[model samples]
Each structure stands twice: as C-alpha cells, then as structure tokens.
Target: MATLESFLKDAAQGDLVPWSSQVLAAQRFDLSLATVEGTILYLDLLPARYQRNRNMISIKQQRRLFNSHAVVIGCGGLGGYVLEQLARLGVGRITAVDPDTFEEHNLNRQLLSSPRLLGHAKVEVAASRITDINPAVTVVPVLAAFGEDNGVEIVAGADVVVDAVDNVPARFALANICGAAGIPLVHGAIAGWYGHVATQYPGDTTLQKIYSRFKNGKGVESELGNPSFTPGVAASFQVAEACKVLIEEGDALRHRKLHLNLLDMEVVDVPF
Candidate 1:
C-alpha cells in the first residue's frame, strides 16, 4: 500500500500539487480531495491554486489555513465578497448566515447577486458559489437572521467571525456573540466610497465604542449607499485580517481602525 504522501510527491509538479494530482490521490486512496489536499500541505507541498500564496504564506501556514474555519455573518455585499475570497484562499470550512434573499437592489454591488438569483436566499447562493469556487472547501449555509437565539450557535467552533452586517444593531449583536464564544471577529463595513476594518478579540469593547455612537438603528450607509467597489475593497481587507488571525502571524487590526476613503484617495490606520 503506497502512502498518500508518496503518491502526492510523485504526482506533484515540483512542490505544487495540481488539481489533477489531488483528484488522482483521492480516487486511489478512497479519500476526499480535501483529505488529499491536507496530506499534501502537511507534507510541505503547496496546492497549485495556492501557489501564489507561497513565500508570504509558507506550506505550514497554508496547511493551517486548510484546517481553519471562518464564519461570515451576513452574506450580502461584504459577506459575498468575503466568502468568495475565503473559499478561493482555501479556508477549508465556511459558515454563511443571512436572513434575506437577493433583491434587485443587490445587483449594483454584490458579487453573488445576479438577475436570475434575485429571489434566491443569500446564504444558499453563497454556499453554491463557494462550492463552485473551491470544491475542496466546505460551505455551511444558514438561511436565518443572526439574533440572540441563534448568534452563539451560528458562530460556534469558528476560528474567526467576520462582521459583514450592514446595520449597527447587528454589528453590536455579532460583537457580543463573538465575545461570548471568545472568537476573534474581523469587522468590516462599507458605505459609498468610505469604509472601515477592525478586529475585535474576546473582551474587546471596540464594537461598543464604534456602534454605540451610531444610533437610529443603522449607520451612514442608509444615506450614502454602497457602490460596487467599496465592498470589494472592504472585504479584501477583512479577509486579510481574518487570514492573519487564522495563521497566527502578523499584526492584526486590533485596538485600531483601518479607515478608507476611496473618493478622497486616502487610507488611514487610526489607533484607538
């Protein structure tokens, strides 16, 4: 019986494991492609898709990513882009939660939103989209709002939670939920060309300070409106922070806020 590692080594093109090689290994060993992927990474071989993630992310860190799970609350604009990036980044497992279905208004900004998906549930679409983007990654779609009853359960066992909710109230609730679970939350919000990204570790009161000041149930987005570019930029930053949190490397955006104003051509990292 040949070891899985031996088969992977033989199939690999240099240090990179091609998708064909992963499929072959899974077929031979009667294992899942994810299992084969993990084996290759554990053996210090990089999957071809993640070859660009090398140098910056070592084989060990890539494997760490493969073992990590991130829960994204709200599969809307920020959540949509975040889920896409996380799946493509090989996060292994993702939980996408959202209560609403895709609306006509979503087409302007949401990556997953299309004319045919207008009436479809966001989380369901998110799950399908993630799987289509990365077959080896698992997508757990929860088609429900995040509230007191389901917040904790929604985020359970997640390595990190991303705040993509469009409202201030939901952000506060999500922060409390993450606090209770002791899971780090990568917070992101976008309105027009202005957006911000921050990290809230367990016991961090940053969300209170950030959201308490904004009453009226929602943030400035109600008036300004999110354009197509903001969510992509904001989600990109959020994924970067989440990746850092999962890999246990680099300085996370804790105790500080990364504020961006594309309209003004400025990106300021403000310490709180």
Candidate 2:
C-alpha cells in the first residue's frame, strides 16, 4: 500500500474529481478512500466528494463531521434516509441499530428497502448502502432491539443519537438514555403528510413533555401509515439537525420541534 502523502502527490489534479474517481484512485493505491480524502483535505484541496458541502460548512466543520460518531436507532423509514445523508456528509462512524426486516410495505419510503432486499435485516441493508455511498464511512449495524436494557450501552460514546423509531415508547426510552448520557438526540417522526423534527440535549425534558399524552401508546404513524415523502422529508431534517450539532453551527431545533405539513405546504417551529 502506498503512503497517503505519496498517493496524494501522485493523484494530484488541477481540478477536483468526483467521489467515484477518488475511490478508484484509492483502490489503485491499496488505501482507504477516506485516507485519500483526508490527505487532499490536509492539503487544502477540495475533493469533488464534498464540494457542495463547502458553502454550507467550513472545512473545519467538515473535518469535525468526519471525526464525529452518530448513532441511529430503528433503521426503517426515517433511519434509512438519515443514514444515507450522514454517509454522504462524511460522518466518520455510525452505529445503526435495527431489529426488524424489510417487508413489502417498506417499499413505499424506506430508502434501503427494495423488492430485492425484502425480508433482509434493515441494519444489514444499511451497511451495504453506506459502503457504496462512501467507503470512508464505517457503519456498525446492530441486529438487536434498543430497549431499556441496552439503550444506554447502544448510545454510549456517541456524539449524537438519532430517534428514528416508530413508536413513542421507544423514542422516550432513547431520549432518556441520551439525556442521561449527555448526548444530543435528533428526533424525527412521520405520519402521513405530517412529520416533526426536534433536537434534544441533555437536561432537556422536551421529549417527555411532547409525548406526555401517549408515553405508553403507539405513535400516530400506527394509525396513519407513512407516505413516501413524509419519511424522506423528516429524515432529511433529522440529518440536517445532526450535522448542525456535530459541526456546532447553526441554531438547532433545540427545545423545539419543526412541524411539517406537505399537503398545506407550511412549516411551523413549535417551542416547548
């Protein structure tokens, strides 16, 4: 394997190349694509992989994202898209927890679910997808339920936790775990044309306060099955929130929820 410094010198181009090209160069050098990317970044040269992310986030923030660890519980609707975006954004490592398999019903919105992947474990599919999206991203797929017993351990050492679970009870459990761990949790839920996104930090009771009425009951998603767009939109919001927290930029949805109604084309930021 060639050293990263020499590889960068050999592959130096006057113009930026796409991520796929970077991957090919890394393969030729028998090096991880991330190593090439980091070397290029160290030289203050922008790889085409994250060129678009430059205007929104500084190079330092981009480096921060590459060094952050994010945990996503429940790899289904919202989880699928959240993982997709995080991988593209160059989040260094991700722990994806999902105990379910893809069903025929998941074809509607689950980004990683397809007829070919039906019945496959969600976490397994997530692993494959991120590998293709960005070889630099390390995805640890857990084939277990995130319950009270393992909730704390699941999110331990994480820089951020994402609540992509479908039920209110699981959300509460994850929220409590994150609060106790002092980790920020980005929450997103979709029910038909309506969805919500929130950023909850340690010592914040926003989650408990929001779900106080139905802590033990199923979420509205149970009654109103998700549409294709709802989960996609909500997951995008969740990824954006997580990125902001990781980069420590932008005002988070902290202690507040961004409600979306696609049918009416309106967004309301509700504060607790």
Best by lDDT: 1
**Whole-model lDDT per candidate:** 0.90, 0.86
Give the TM-score comparing model 1 with the true structure, all chains together: 0.96
Per-residue C-alpha lDDT of model 1 across residues 150-262, encoded as one tens digit per residue: 89888999999999987777788899989989999999988899999999999997777876567576667889989999999999999999999999989999998999999
- Candidate 2: regions farther than 4 A off: 1-3, 14-30
**Model 1 lDDT, full chain set:** 0.90
Across 100-171, the per-residue lDDT of candidate 2 in tens digits comes to 999999998888999999889999999999998888887899999888998988998899999998888788
TM-score quality measure for candidate 2: 0.92
